[model samples]
Structures are given as structure tokens and as C-alpha cells.
Target: MITTKDLQHLFALIAADIAAHRDHLCELDGAIGDGDHGLAMDAGCEASVKAVAALDPAQATPAAAFNTAAKAFLNAVGASSGPLYATAFMRAGAAVKDRPDLSDEEFLRAFAAMAAGIQERGKAEPGEKTMVDAWKPAADAALDAWASGASLLECFDLAERAARQGCEATRDMTAAKGRASRLGERVIGHIDPGAASAAIIIASIAKFVEQHDSCRIDM
Candidate 1:
């Protein structure tokens, strides 16, 4: 089961990871974007984690934490990623509304919902050299692993792996959406900053699950 505490920890890990990779993400964006992707992601994640952390664990549900994070992220980031990730967290909150904790299945559903929300909000698909390349594959991998009777940790591990691969694959893809789209073939050979950040987010989830031995769920 994943409690609000776990969700809070997850966001904290995400914020830390994003901050640590800020320079790398900015460099990637410099290849095809305005080079502010890292700064936006770092600020948004940091704000989200802080907002969630301020919640009282005794009263905060997982959904509430997600909602709080969503609002903070949106308010902190003025870039396109702001709305996209805010929508993702909102959908994740909706997926487990009213729940104080989440079962493995509920967690998977929320994860998938986040990806779906990102796709819907951004109107981007795989091969678009965008975050969807990472998010969609991570969600799919989680679902597939869960369906195969994997533990929550295993499922998230697979998700992280898929997200990383998707991020790497973006290096070979031409931008088909966002400002990078205007670059045409010039964007190829460089990984998408959005995809890189998405991978970091997914990996944070996996890392949190791994560190917590109680994160397992019955299949």
C-alpha cells in the first residue's frame, strides 16, 4: 500500500532528482528549445514537494497530496511543462480520489492516468520527441508488469526502465511537437529535455518503492 507519506516521499525524491539534473536538462533543451526546461522543472518539482510536505500527514490523503503538488507545480512553472505536469497530477489525484492509501492496482491506475492526462493536455504521441515518449511507455510498462503478477516494486522498476529507454530513443527522433518541432531535423540526435525529465520523475517513483520494503502489493 502507498500512503500519503509515501506519496510525499516520492515527490521529494522527484524534486531532488530534478534539481540535481537541472544543468543536464538545460543543456539538452539548449539543443532544441529555449534552454529553460531544467530551470522550470527544478522549480516546479521543488515547489510541489514543499507543498505536499506542508500537509499534515494525519489528515492528508494520497489524492490530497497529489492535488496540492499539482497546484504548486502549476503555479511555480510558467513554461509549457507547468500545465502538462499539473494536468498529470490532477488526473492522478482523480484516479484515487478519497483514498487515504493506494493498493497496487490503484497505484497503477493513477500512474496510467497521469500519462493519459499528459498526452491529452499536450496532444502529443510517441515518436514526437516529447515527454509523452517517456510517460506513455512507462505507464504501459507498469500496467503490463502489474498484469503479469509483479509486485509494486517490480512494476515500477519496469516502468523506470521503459521510461529511460524512451528517453534515450528520443535522441533518434525528430521533433514533431512543441517548440522543438520548429527545429525539424536539427533536433535529431539530441534527447528531448521533456523526455529526460519524465524519466527522472518515473525513476524517482521506482527509487522510493525500492527503498521501502513495505511497498509490495498482493497480485
Candidate 2:
């Protein structure tokens, strides 16, 4: 079962990745964006970590922990992406509602809801040169791998690969969402900032789950 600890670990991993890739993320944003993606995400995820860490254990259920981070991310982030990402986790937490210890199926439900929420709210899709491009693929892979009776770790692995491939695919897509959409064909060949950040977060989650997972089957 995935506990609050597991969710905390996910936040920590993303925090570390944000630290390591801050400059890179900014560099990517600089290419086709306002060049503030790195700082914006760093602030958001860092605040998310602090929010999770400071959770009053007395009140810290799995759902509450996620909700706290979502709220904190919104409070700390000041970019166009902030509301989008904040909505993702907030929707996920709402999906899980009162659950404290979540099963693999529940985890799927939460994240799948997050993916769908982000897509719907952003009005974007896979290959739209947006975050949904990466997230939609990862979400699809997660569901597919799990339904095929794959181990939880295997499911994450598949999701991670799909997110990465989707990020790369954004490079060839004409931006049809966000600021990139304003550039039209000029957006092609430039990676979308939202897609890149989403890929990093998904990859970080997969890596965390694999390294700290204590119960993944060997299948």
C-alpha cells in the first residue's frame, strides 16, 4: 500500500530533480518561453516539499498530504503553469478523498484523475506541444501496464518511458497550446516548457517508486 511516506518520497525526489535541473529547465524555457520556468517550478516544488514535511502528523493523511502540497504549490508558484499543476494534484487529492493508505489501484485512480484533470483544464492533448503531450502518454502507459498484470514498478517504468518519448515528440509538434501556440510553426523544433517539466516530474516519480518501493512484485 502507498502511504503518506510514499507520497512524501515522491515530493522529495521531484525536489531533488528540480534542484539538479533548475538551470536546464530555465534554459529550455528561454528557448521558446519567458525563461522563468526553472525558477517558477523550483519555487513551487520546494514549497511543496516544505509543506509535506511540515504536515502535522496528527492531520497528515495521504490525501491531506497531497492536498497540502497542491495548495502550497499554488501559493509559491507565480507562473501560468502554477495553476495548471496545482489543479492536477488538487484534483488527484480530491479523487482519493479520505484515503490514508492507498492501494496500487487507488494510486492509479489518483494519478489518472490528475492526468485527466490537467488535460481538461488546459484544453490540450498529447502531441499538442504541451504538458498533456507528456502526461497523457504516461497516464495511458500506466493504465496499460497495470492492466496487463505488470508489477507496480513495471508500470512506473512504462509510464516514465512514455513521458520521455512524449516530451521528445513535442519537439516536432507545432505548439497548439499556451504561449507556444502564439508562435505557430516557429514553435516546431523547440520543446515545450510545460512538456519538459511534466516529463521531469513523471521520471522523478518513477525513479522514486523504484528505489524506495518495498513491495513491488518481481514480475
Per TM-score, the best of the predicted structures is 1
| Top candidate (lDDT) | 1
TM of each candidate vs. truth: 0.96, 0.94
Write candidate 1's Cα lDDT for 1-219 as tens digits. Answer: 789988888898999999999999999999899999999999999999999999998899999998999999999999999999999999999999999899878988999999999999999989989999999999999998888899888999899999999999999999988899998898889999999999999998888878775534333
Error of 1 at 174 (Å): 1.0
Score residue 65 of candidate 1 by CA lDDT. Answer: 93
Q: Which stretches of candidate 1 lie over 4 Å from their true place?
A: 214-219
Candidate lDDT scores, in order, read 0.93, 0.85
